[model samples]
Target: MPQTNGNAPGRCAPIPKTIPPMKDLTTENITENVIALNNLCSDPRTRYLFERLVHHLHDFARETQLTSEEWMSGINFLTAVGQISDDLRAEMILLSDTMGLSLLMDAIAHPRVPKATEGTVLGPFHTHDAPVTDNGYVLHDDPGAEQLFVLCNIKDTEEQPLENVQCDVWEGDSHGFYDVQKGADRQGPDGRAVLRSNSEGVFYFTAVVPVPYPIPDDGPVGGMLKLLNRHPNRPGHIHFMLETPGYDKLVTALYPRGDPYETSDPVFGVKESLIVDLSLVDEAVADKYGVKVGMKLLTYDFVLASDEQAAELRKDRRKEAAAKLDVDISTLHLD
Candidate 1:
C-alpha cells in the first residue's frame, strides 16, 4: 500500500473523472442540445421562438424518423419556391394561403372583433395605390362580362353609419386576369380604385360581375396543386379594403351571383356574412345608380371594427408591401 498525503502534490489522490451516460445522448438529448444553442441568440423574442421551434421540429422529426433523403427533398422544394419568386409574384405567401395557414392565423388574431367586419387574406396581387375615384365610378378597365353595380355601406358595429371612410376595391376581369398580370408594362391601377364613402356612409361602384377564375398556377404553387389534385381557382368575388378614422378597417371580398367555386374558395376567404345576393332587376333600379339597365345589382353592407383593430389591419398591408420590396423594414425608418 502506498501512503498518500493530501497536502503534497505527488501524494495527492487521483481525481475522479465523471462522464455523462451514453443513453443521455439519444434523440431527446440532441434536442436538448439544440435548445441550449439558443442561448447564443441576443434577441429575447427571437431566442424564445427559436427554442420552442427547435423543440417541436426535433420532436416531429424523431416521431416520424424522417430520413435524410426526405429532408433534402423538402429543402429542394423550399428552394424552388424561393427561386420562383420575382417582382410580381410571391410563392411563399401563396403556399401558406393554399395550405390554410394564412386563414387560420387570421382567425386567431382577429377573434370576435365586434362591429368589425370579418377579415380575409388579401392575396398577393394588391396594388400599393389604386386609382382614386369618386363615389360612383367604374373600376372595370377591360370589358368581358355583363355589367353589375355594387352598392355598399360602411357602418359601425352599433349599426350607426360611418362617413368619409376610404374604400379600396379591386377585382379581375371576366377572363380571370388582373391588369398587372396581363403584361409587364401594363401596371398602373388598371382594375383597382380607392373611393370615399358618401355622407350617408354609402359607396357605389359599377363593374362587370366577376367570374370565378384560377389563381396563377404556372409556378411552384401550381406544382403543389397538381400534386395534391387541387385546383388553384378562387370564386368570383370583388375585394374590399375599407378604413375609417375611428373604426377598424375591413378586408374582405363579396362573392358574385352564382359563383361555382363559392363553396370551395381556394384561399378560404368566403364568409356567410360577406356574400351578397345579386338580384336581376328591371332597368328602373339600375338607372338610379347610373348603371346600365337590365344588369344585375349586388348590394351589401360593410361593418367596421373598432379603431384599434382597423390600425392592426392596416399594419398587415404595410408589412406585405415591405416584404415585396425585400428591404430591411427597420432600416427604412418609415412613418
Candidate 2:
C-alpha cells in the first residue's frame, strides 16, 4: 500500500503534488497570503470570517508594532486562561466580556426588534438544571438579606398574552455569590429557578434583591482588567430568559435603577431600557408577595418577537454586516 505518512519504521511518503507554493512572506504581502491559505475551505462562512480576521490581525500587529516579547506574554496569558478554566468557570468568556467583545457580538446578533424585548449578554454562570417552581414561589428566604418579590408579565408584540412561556430567573445572593461559585459542597439551588408563565402571562416569585457583584477576578481576565485600569464589578441585576414555541427566546436581565456601578459595568451588559424602577413596600404591599414588612418589589413586562420576525431581523443584520465587508449577502451565513 502507498504510505500517506512516515508511519512505519521511518518510511516516509512523498509530498503531495497538488500543493501550491507560497510567496516569500513580508509584512506587506503576508496578510493576503495568509488569507489565501484558506482559499480552498469548503465552508463559505468559515472562509468569510477567517479572511476578515486575518486582515484585522495583520493590521493590529502593524499598528501597534508589537514586539516578540509582548506577543509571548499574550500567548502565556491565553494559555493560563485555558489552564484555569473547567466545567464550573469559563475564563474565555470572562476574557471576552471584560474586553467588551461579548456584548458587541450580542448587539450585532440580536439587533433591536420594534416592540420586542431587548437582550444582553448571557453570563457564564447560567445553569441548565435549575429547579422548576410554580408562580408565587419564594426563591429565597434568608434572614440576613432583605426580601424581594419579582413579578413578570409576558406578552407578544401585538400585546397578546403568551401562555406557557419558559422564564428562567437567576442571580447571585446578597453577598454576590452564585450557588455554583460556592464550590463542590453546595447543597441545592440558591437564587435561581425555572418557571413557566401562567395563563395570564404572569409569574410572581419572592427573591432577594440582587446585590452588585464582581466578576471572578482571580484569573487572567482579572489581571488584564487591572492592567487596563478597569473594575470587574457589574450592577445589581436579575437575569430572565423567556422561551416559547413560536417566538424568539429572550435572554435578558433587569438592572435596578440606582446601583452605583450602573454607569460603568465592566462587562457592558446593562442597558438603559432594561433598567427597572424598584419600589419599597410597606406591610400591606409586602403581604401580597409574602415578603417582610419592609422589603422591595420589582415588576417588569416583556414583549416577545415571533420566529418569523426574529429571522427577518437576523437576515437584515447579516446583510448589513456583509455590506461592510463588500461580500455578497447570499454568500454569508445567516447565523
Candidate 3:
C-alpha cells in the first residue's frame, strides 16, 4: 500500500475524481433550487402564491445578498409580532397597514364597487353592540374641543333611500383615546354607538371632532417604525360600519379637514372621496339637529352595493357580535 504523509497503510486513498466541487454551488443555484421547490406545490392557490413569493423572495435575497443572520433576525421580528397580539389587539394587521399592504389590498378587493361607498381598513378598534342610541345622540358623551356634527345618509347608488340601515360608528376623543381605552365607563361600550338610518336615508350624531393620534408603539411594529424613522400617527378620522338589507355593507373612515396627516396617513387609509370639510354651522342650524351653534358639521352619503352582498355583510355583523362576546368574556371576565 502507498504510505500517506500522516496515515497508516490502507487508511489513505486518492479523492474521487468524479466528485463535484462544492465551490460551484452558488447563490444563483440556490435560488433556482428554491424556485423549483416552490413549483412542487400541488394546490392551485398554494402553487400560485408560493411561486410568486419564492420569485420575489429570491430576488430580494439576491438584491440584498441577505445573510443568514439577517434572515434569522427577520424571522425573530415576525415571531415577536405574533406574540404581542391578544383578543383586543391585532398587531399583524397594524403591521400590514403601516407597510401599506392593507391599503393596497383594500383598494384592489373593494374596487369602486360601482357607485357604492369605497371601503377602507376596519382599523383594529371596532367593538360590537355599541349602545343603540337615537339618531341624534352624541357619540362622545363628554364635552371636548373641536365640536363635531355628523349627518349620515344611506342609499342605493340610484339615490333611493335605505330605511332602517344600521350604522355602527366610533371615534377617538379630542385626546385621541377611545372610551374603552380610557376605561371611562365599564357599564357600556365607550366611544361606540349604533343607529338606524331613517326613512329619508339620514342619520345624525354629535361628538367632539376626534384628534389625530399615533398607533400603539409598544409592539414590534412600533419598533420597526422607529427603526425606519417614521411616525406612527394616523390622521383624525371617524370610523363607520354601515349596512342595509337591500345594499352592500360598508366599512370605512371619514377624514377630517385640515388634519396634518390627512393626505399622508400613516396607515394609508384616506380616500379623496372620503375627505370632507367639516364646516362650522350656525347655532340655529345645529339646534335643528339638537347640536349647539358653531359646531362643526360633516356630511356624507353612503351608497350600498347590491342586495346579495348586503345580506352577507349583515351576516358578518352577526358573526362579529358573537366573536366580540367571546373576546370580552375571555379577557375581561364579563358576559
Candidate 4:
C-alpha cells in the first residue's frame, strides 16, 4: 500500500526498490578489482610488482579452485616457518633455497659476467667477522678428514694477477656439519676461514675434502620437503667469496668432480666451470706446496670483471627485465 504525504495533491511517497544481487562474482571481475587497486601505489616499481603479484595469485587460486582448507594449511605452514626462524637459522631462506629460487635470483642478478667466474648461492651458513689468516693456513685439523690443499689464483680478464684481493673460503667438516651446527663441546672451527691474495694474486689453504651432505632439514622446511617427496642434500663444495677494489665481487663454490649429488644439489649451486678435479700429489710435490704427503691438491683460477664491464652488464639486465614485463624501459629508470 502507498501512503500520501498531502504536501501536494495526488503526490505519493515512492516505495524503496530492492537492491539487486551483487554482480555475480567472476574470475575476470576479481582480477580486474585487484589490479585496479594497484593504481593507488605511488611508486611505479611497487605498483607494477603488486599488480603482477595480485594477478598471478588470483589466477593460481582460480585455476586450482583452491579450497579453504588448502589455503588455511598454506598459511599455517608459512606461520610455522616464521615461528622457527632466528639468528642462526632462516627458515624462509631455507624454503627458497630448497625451491631453487635463490639460485634463480643469483642468475638474474649476475648474468654470467664474461671471463668472470659464474656465481652461486651464498648459503645461509656464512657469518661475518671471520678470523683472518695468512696464506697457507689450515682452518680445521679434523683428524677424520683427508687433508686437501687449495691453491687459488685470482686474475683479471687479461690474465694478469690482481693484488689485494680478499679470498674468503669456508666449508663443512668431514661429517658434513658446519661449526654452527655442532654441539658447544666441539673443538676448533670446522671449515671456515679467510685469507688475502698476495701481490701475485695467489693464496693457499689446507681444508678437508668437502663431502656431500644434507642441508639442515630438521625444521619446518624439512617437513615441507618430506611432504613434497624431495631430498635435502647439497653436493661436496667449498664456498668462496672473492672481493677487491675495482672489480665485481664474486660469490662462488667449487664442487668436487665426482660428488654423487652434483647434478641434484638441493640449492642448485653447482656451476660447470666451478667444478675441480683434485689431484693426489706425491710427498716430493706436496712438500713444495707445504701440504702433507699422500694428500690432494686443487688448483683453480678466478677471473673478475672490471667496474665498467659490470655497469654495462647492469644496463643490459635492466633492458631484459623491462622486456620481460612488457613495459617501457623508462618506467624502470631511477630518479
Candidate 5:
C-alpha cells in the first residue's frame, strides 16, 4: 500500500481527512490524481495552469505512446538545456524560441496598436551593457562588412514627433555575428549602442548591413532542431528597442527586403510590416548621417502607442506572467 502520510519518505504532507485517500494510479487515472493534489496550490492561476499542463503533458505521452527510452531522452535533453545556460547564453529561451512558443507568446502579448510599430521576438542576443552614444554613432568596424547608414524617427500614434526617446540598437556584421557572439564578454562591447533621438525625433548610426546567420546551435536546442529536421537560420535584420515617457516601449526588428531566409526565419520573427527598403545614397545624404559616401541608407519610421492603450491590451497576459513563470522578465529577451 502507498503511504498517505506526510511523514512518508520524500513525500509531501498528509492528505486532509476531508479528502479520501488516492487509489493506485493507472494510465487513465494518473492525470486526474495529479490535478486533484494540485488543487491545493494557493494561487488560483497557478492551480489552473498546473491543471492544464498536466492534462496536455499526460495526453501527449498517451497519444504518442512514448516509450521509456524516448522519455529518458527527453529528460536528458532538458538537463542539457539547464546545464548549458548561463548569464551569457540562455538555452531555455532558445528552446522556447526553436519550438515557436516564443513567437506565439509575442503575438498574444503584443497586439496591433493602430498605426504603431509591431513587436517581434527579442532574440537571445540583446545585451544591457551597450553604451549610450551621440546621435551619429559608429557601432561596428568589420573589414568585411558593407557600409550602411541607419536613420530612425520616432513619433506618437497621432503623428507628432517624440523627442528625447531612447533607442537601443544592435545588429550583426557582414559575416552575421554579433559582438557578443564574437566573445565580447571578455573583449568589451561592439555592434550595439543606446542612442537618443533628437528634436526631430531622430537617431543616426553607422552600421554594416546585417546578414543571415544560424542561431547559436551547439546546444540542446540545436540538437532538438536537428531531430525535427528544421533549419535554424534567421534573416538579416536590425533590432530596435524604443522607450520614452508615457509611451509603450517597442521591441522590434527590421528585415531587409531581399534576404532569402526571410520567408523561413526559424523563430517566426518576420512579419510583412517589418520588411524594409534600402537605398544606395549620394555623398550628400551620407554626410548628413555622418558616414562616408556610397553607403546604403535605410530609413525606418516608428509610431508608439500610449501607455494607457498598452496597459489595456496587455492585462490578460500580464496576469498569467505574474503567476510565477519561474523567470525574471528582465533577464529574458522577450521583455
Candidate 6:
C-alpha cells in the first residue's frame, strides 16, 4: 500500500489530483447570488433595494480588492459614529453633508425652478425652535464683531411680495462658534433668530459677518477627512429657512463674494444664484433699514416656489419622506 506523506514526521500528504479547485465566480453569478438571497424580502421595494445594494457593494469590494482589515476599519468607524450621536448632534448628517450626499438629495428632491431660490444643505446647526423676534432684531450683539445688515425680499415667481412668511436665520460667530458649540455659560442663540417677512416681503436683521469655519471635526468623520488628506472647512454663510402657508418651505444659504472658501465649500452648498455681495452702506441708505451709518449691508431677493409647484416637483420625495417620518404623504407640506 502506498503511504501518504502525512506518515512522515512534520510532513503532509500531497493534494489529490481529483480534488477540484474552489468554485470560480463570474460577475453575473456574484450579483445573481445576492438577488436570489434577497428576492424573498417581505417588501417588494425593500427586496429590490437590497438586491441592488448588495450587487453594487459586492462589486465595489471585489474591484478594490478590499482587505478584511480595511473592511473591519470601516465597520469600526461607523460604530463610532453611532456611539457619539445625541439630540444636539448628528454625526450621520455630518457624514452625509461632508460627502455631498445631502446636497445631492436636496437637488434630486427639489429640482430648480425658474426664478425660485436654489436650495442648500440644512447644516448641522439649524434648530426648529429658534427664538422668534420682530424684523431688524440683532443676532450678533457680541461686542467687537463687525455688524452686517441682512435684508432679504421674499417673493413669488411673479415677483409679488409674500407676507407673513417666517425666515429662520442662523450663522456662526466671528470666532466660528455656534451657540450650541459653546459651553453652557455661553448665552443662548449667539447667532440665530427667526423673523417674519414684512408686508412687502422684506425681512431685515442685524448680524455679525459669519466667518469661515470647519464642521465639527472631533469625531469619526473628521478622522476620515484626515485619512483622505482633506480639509474640513465650510465657507462662511448664513443659513435660511423660509416657511409660510400656500408656499413651499425653502432652505438656503447666502455666500459672500469673497469668503475664502466660497468656491471650495467642503459641503458643496454654494450656488451661483445664492452668492451675493455685501457693500458698505452710506448714512442715508443705512438709516433706511434702521442700521447706523457706515455698517455693511447685504441685499437679496428670494423667490419661493408656490405650494402647487413644490408638490408637483417633490411628489415622489414626499411619499418617501412621509414613509420615513411615519406620516401620511397628503398631510406632509413643505415646511
Task: Report lDDT per candidate.
Answer: 0.76, 0.84, 0.76, 0.81, 0.83, 0.82
- Please, what are the lDDT tens digits per residue for candidate 3 over residues 1-335? 32223433586665423222233457678655565545555565566556557778888989998999999989999999899877566889889989889887776545565578888988878887588888987776565467688887888877888888889999887888765554324556667899999889899888778789988888899999999988888898899988766555678999877888887777889888888787877867676776777767888888888766544544554456548655332222111
Task: Provide TM-scores for the models.
Answer: 0.79, 0.91, 0.75, 0.86, 0.86, 0.81
- What is the C-alpha lDDT profile of model 1 across 1-335, one tens digit per residue? 22233343786665233222233567758876666556456665576668668878988899899999989978898899899877667788888889888887776555546556787878877877688889778887665677777888888878878888999998888687787686577757666899999889999888778888888898878888898899788988888888766665567788864678888888888887777778764677666666666677888888877866645654665466559867454432323
Stretches of candidate 4 exceeding 4 Å from the true structure: 1-26, 183-189, 282-288, 330-335
Q: Is candidate 2 or candidate 3 better by TM-score?
A: 2
> Residue-wise lDDT of candidate 2 within 7-28, one digit each (tens)?
3345666543333456579989
What 10-residue stretch in candidate 3 is worst by lDDT? Answer: 326-335
Name model 3 segments beyond 4 Å from true: 1-43, 180-188, 282-288, 307-335
Could you tell me the TM-score of candidate 4? Answer: 0.86
Q: Which stretches of candidate 5 lie over 4 Å from their true place?
A: 1-20, 315-335
Candidate 1, residue 34: lDDT: 63
User: Candidate 5 residues 55-161, lDDT tens each?
Assistant: 99999999999999999999999999999888778889988887789888877767777898999988888999998999888888787778788888899988999
Q: What is candidate 4's local distance difference test score?
A: 0.81
**1-335: candidate 6 lDDT, tens digit per residue:** 32233333456665333222223567557676557646645666566558658978988988898899999998999999999877667888999998999999889767776679999999888866578999989997578899898888999999999998989999888888788777455556668899999999999998888789998899999998888888888888899999999887899999888887888787899998988889877887676776787788888999999988876767767677779967545454433
Count of backbone collisions in candidate 6: 0
Using TM-score as the measure, the top candidate is 2
The superposed Cα distance between candidate 3 and the true structure at residue 206, in angstroms, equals 1.6
lDDT of 1: 0.76
Which pairs clash inside model 5? none
